[model samples]
Target: MRRSAEPDPSGEQAPHWWQRAVFYQVYVRSFADSDGDGVGDLEGIRSRLGYLELLGVDALWLTPFFRSPMADHGYDVADPRAVDPLFGDLAAFDRLVTDAHAHGIKVTIDVVPNHTSDQHAWFQEALAAAPGSRERARYLFRDGDQPPNNWVSVFGGPAWTRVPDGQWYLHLFTPQQPDLNWDNSEVRADLVETLRFWLDRGVDGFRIDVAHGMAKPAGLPDMPEYLRSVTGAQAHGVDDPRFDNDEVHEVHRLIRKVADEYPDTMAVGEIWVQTDTQFAKYVRQDELHLGFNFALVDADFDADAVRRAIDLSLEAVSRSAAPPTWTLSNHDVVRHVTRYGGSELGARRARAMALVQLALPGVVYLYNGEELGLPNVELPDWALQDPLWERSGHTDRGRDGARVPLPWEGTEPPFAFSEGTNTWLPIPPEWAGLTVERQLEDPDSMLSLYRQALELRKTHAGFSGTDIEWYGAPPGCFAYRRKGGGLICALNTSGAPVPLPPGEILLSSGPIPTTDLPPETAVWLI
Candidate 1:
């Protein structure tokens, strides 16, 4: 069994601010472009603080804006403390943080501790030094005729890349991102410094990228035969040698130590462990403050699948008494709208899921454009930029579709996301109907639904609880109520309409044609 963190001198542990807050994920480059450079930047985010406040999110989790070569779109960090010129400078980030605070929104940024860009000074020095030099100690390098092991890259290909010195280094994602050796004291200390650098700048928290990574298994071993071929969503299930090792807990503890130094700072990890016991380990009292449970993100639109995901997620976090985190879509995967079935039906189902998600008792992370009910775009081959595209020899179209720039206020390509006609990823012309400007004017648009739900979540007494109670419903529907509050949430995925539980209707995902709930619809009641 696990216990909560030690209580304060007052003898009661006050809930952290993030416990009940909704975090909006801003994939920096695709969010907004202030300079018409065809890419979004920190200044662009600072310009949009008002919109986020209006949308009612309590915090903003900005993806990597750290100095990087952009091989992995900022995941391959070259300098963890410096702001990438592509985004802005240190002064710009400080302004964004200060302004966001003025709007009552906490700001959290991504930290990629598992690896650094190959262009980093350390990697450059390692390349020039002898195989056994001190510079080589910072990363995972071993002399080998073959790759150090049979492990496969998450982006598709051998995980090891050989150098002219006849030594191979491990890069689990792309060659540009070399995995750091957590066993190296210097590497661990540098990560601590990185955390303090941003915390000292007043960041409210961090979204730790690949929190389950960093600690590699002993002897640089090959993965078991059965797990080698697993990739993508299924990869989390098998015990791949690449991630989720037992030693990873020590790395998280180091992060937590630094986070505790700053008042009200938090650490939420991007964990993908599937088993309840394994997942719970990352959020234990001494480890990450919270860990993302991706079961719901992987769930389909079916009622049973959604219910199972919810139940499993709750169980996983209950062990540590940590608040569970939920998200339907992110920059890495296919958007939930497209995953639910794509088109009008997909939008309807996505809206229903939002009600289901927001009604639950924990933190919610809404990916940008999700509130607009955005679906994945089918970009031409030339438009694909995800490393997976080239790494997979183009067989996998990659995540570029889900990362298309948001449609803000225009009727054509770029959709005013950039001043020029081009965006990093093109916004489809058909999205004119889904622009934020258009949605704001419509009383019944997806944006409207989210705004109303967020307002209610912030003010309604019915949302005041930490647990939920399941209710009996029809064959393809499920209902649950906040354990302490009287709020009730019901969803119907059946072929026909079903009777609603007796209560006042607070909101519905779609228009109710009668006194009953329609298929692919959800409702909140009190």
Candidate 2:
């Protein structure tokens, strides 16, 4: 069982640290570089610990850095227990965790339990073993030349690949990654051991990749309808059949049991189910500590869309002990700046949405470069490396645009991302004006807005409650007050100004008009 670090000193009940903590997702390759090796490494993360601390985030969710063939950029784990050499060895990871904790930032590493790299020892052994061997049973191996079912890979193409021995293996993602057979006891025990390996290393938690995908549906039936193998695939809901299988909950239950052994450790799942009830199931008392609902992330910048997204998000977790995790952007999707439509209007809406996200009742996840108001770049076809690029037959540009390395300073390519123009993904030269260095010098920049909001959200008495009450507002606008708390947040989605309600202005995403809230802006009040 988990041990409580802090006893209830005042006898007044409150939530866990993660319930109110602001988490910053650091896509390792794009974040920073200390080794001048073009790719960001664990050493790079340690060097930037102070920056994350000053940014006021309580936790840093580092994307996968495990040993891999880079087929999926660390998500295809060749060695789950070892750190990839590109990101340094286990020692470097340990130093990063220690330095981050010293700076009061918790570290949550990405854990991909759903599949293993085709090159993983287990998979390789399975490939060499006979069809009926125990090694073959550890993964989804089928005897026929045809795939077990018609399920397609998330990246694109057929989901199964035939081995030289004429057997098939399932991979919901790329062919480089083969799905593990969770019904196989060896696979289940291996995952538990992998969890223990990291927990014993002192990492605080895990951001489970494809957490809802660990279990394949019984009998492996083909989907009635085709769905894209991406974030939007979950829109098919309960009967989607490809993911969110009912048995996935048992996987989480086992994981939660393992997590409980380490006090204060958390497991946040990427549960992409559609309905509010479906979304809530992953975070029930015996499952995940938090389930990411992409309702707000996929919503448009319109008033009604934003309102409905929030309603569904809240309703999704209203019945669970776990809080909803909110994020406007992540590594997989297009950055919100470009998604909202680029330039001025896009920037305004992005900032406004940030205010809404930060003022919400639960956990908030900020993707790197978002505070810099970075727009997605239009990369050349040759520059695209997402597996989706190849799998989609070059029809899709893939996620290289949002995965560009962040610019810390300077005015050119690499932008201090590394010593030369050899960054893993090119950093846009135009980002010169949006570097963290430039933004810090300009107090009114997006970086300042986020910094101030995060600090206030952490320190102020106004942001004390979890409940929200809707306030009457004009069309194309929203106003909500925190129940039992002094804070109120209002956003004007209209093109024209809207009247402000009674309260002292605590913070605004942008400058406010003399007597009303300006268009495409959000304000916090008390």
Candidate 3:
């Protein structure tokens, strides 16, 4: 391994830092709790910047912490400019931003663009104004309350909610997150202003939420019934006229214009478009800098599936000459550990996949607690908080299972996540052995493996290129060499073991119990 090819994080010369950065996603309420308020806050994140610095991430993305009613847990922003009291006030956020920069970590916060909190001032005013008034025009308020068209909420209900005035407003998500009418110039202007507000406050960039659905088709129309059950802000969000329309490109272009005002600042979209071509549109030359391709996150832990994920992900980004972004899990989906199989085998695969992701030549995103190899917690019904839990009549388990608080240092429940027992979501009792403190002492632990891989990814010459050349391999196994960089990444997704390619080993997720790589294991070589 060599020293980083890039300049120091504090250096101002690396104008294209985003092209080579590795981002860690910080799920605010679950990352850490400095206030003992049973929730993770910006101050807690500031306190843990050293841990992240040592763990080797270039930057971090904090899920929304702005002023909000917490309807969608901060995604429903009441005021994008103000820090929410729940995550500490503006002063605390400022301190976190200052500290993070000092630690050489860039701060990218979530910006929800497609909708506004129903409790937002604009929405409140819209509710009181006459049907055709400017206030109402800020939103998609329609006449004839028979539930405007047949659109369904992504959270599983009617997208239209009638107000006292007898007109219905559209909300692609839960009614609490009312969809804004982007057709209105005021709506577009406010969003650009919002971007500048945070940029001027010294933040690095933004992770645009629902980045693909901001523009709806003109003349609201009916959608297929099947879309209702799958409609969401997650991976399945791209069907129908309500999402990924060509007009959305204009919205992104305007956003990119605002972001370009801040040097080195970039935007990554939560684009859920179904095809590589459609996904590429969001990352065109004048739009978002990156778009999350969830192929890796949605794939099963098998050789063919994993290969396809990598290929498709890269193809999509290549369409716009944009760099690929990789991740196996995030806030909206089941953790890969649990999704892989929920046992020792599952944990093994998760660790292996982490290397597969880091070995790629693009931005890599690790969700909070992912470094600790945390699995999803199956919460009791009474403890669930995701709106989808109730919105689907309790038939859908929702995302609470994956949002459990991170277990940091302790051996018990709050596990150093908080001083109190009221964490937003309960940590499983069995996670005692997987705490960061414990993993720090075990070289074979998942945490250590991640640190080593990241450290190598940052300094090794083998990780510099974006192109990959595949090598013929046994069934249930895959091997690929990085172009222009003499590095190889191999995986054993089968029940049996496979021999590693001939090269000096750079890293492996765990011990190679034999001459062959174990099942669910991945290795890096040069």
Q: Write down the TM-score of every candidate.
A: 0.97, 0.97, 0.96
lDDT of each: 0.90, 0.87, 0.87
Error of 2 at 504 (Å): 0.7
lDDT of 3 by residue, 168-210 (tens): 8889889899888888999998998898888888888899998
Comparison by TM-score, 1 against 3, better one: 1
Cα lDDT tens digits, model 2, 1-526, are 2345676789887577899899899999888887888998889888878888888899999999889999988889999999888888999998998889899999998989899999999998998899989999999988785778777877778888999889999988899999999899998898899999888888888988888798887789887553644422243556666788888898999899999999888999987776787778889999999988888888999888998999888888888888778998888888999999899889989999999999888999899999989989899887889998899888877788888998888888788877767998877777888988899899989999999999999988888888888998999999998886779999999889999988999999989858699999999999
Put the candidates in TM-score order, highest first. 2, 1, 3
TM-score of 2: 0.97
Off by over 4 Å in 1: 1-13
Backbone clashes in candidate 2 total 0
- Where does the lowest 10-residue lDDT sum fall in candidate 2? 226-235
Model 1, range 8-35, lDDT digits (tens) per residue? 7887887788888899999999999999
State the weakest 10-residue window (summed lDDT) of model 3. 1-10
Better of 1 and 2 by lDDT: 1
Q: What ranges in model 3 sit over 4 Å off? A: 1-15, 235-239
How does model 1 fare in lDDT?
Answer: 0.90
On a 0 to 1 TM-score scale, where does candidate 1 land against the true structure?
A: 0.97
Which structure is stronger by TM-score: 2 or 3? 2
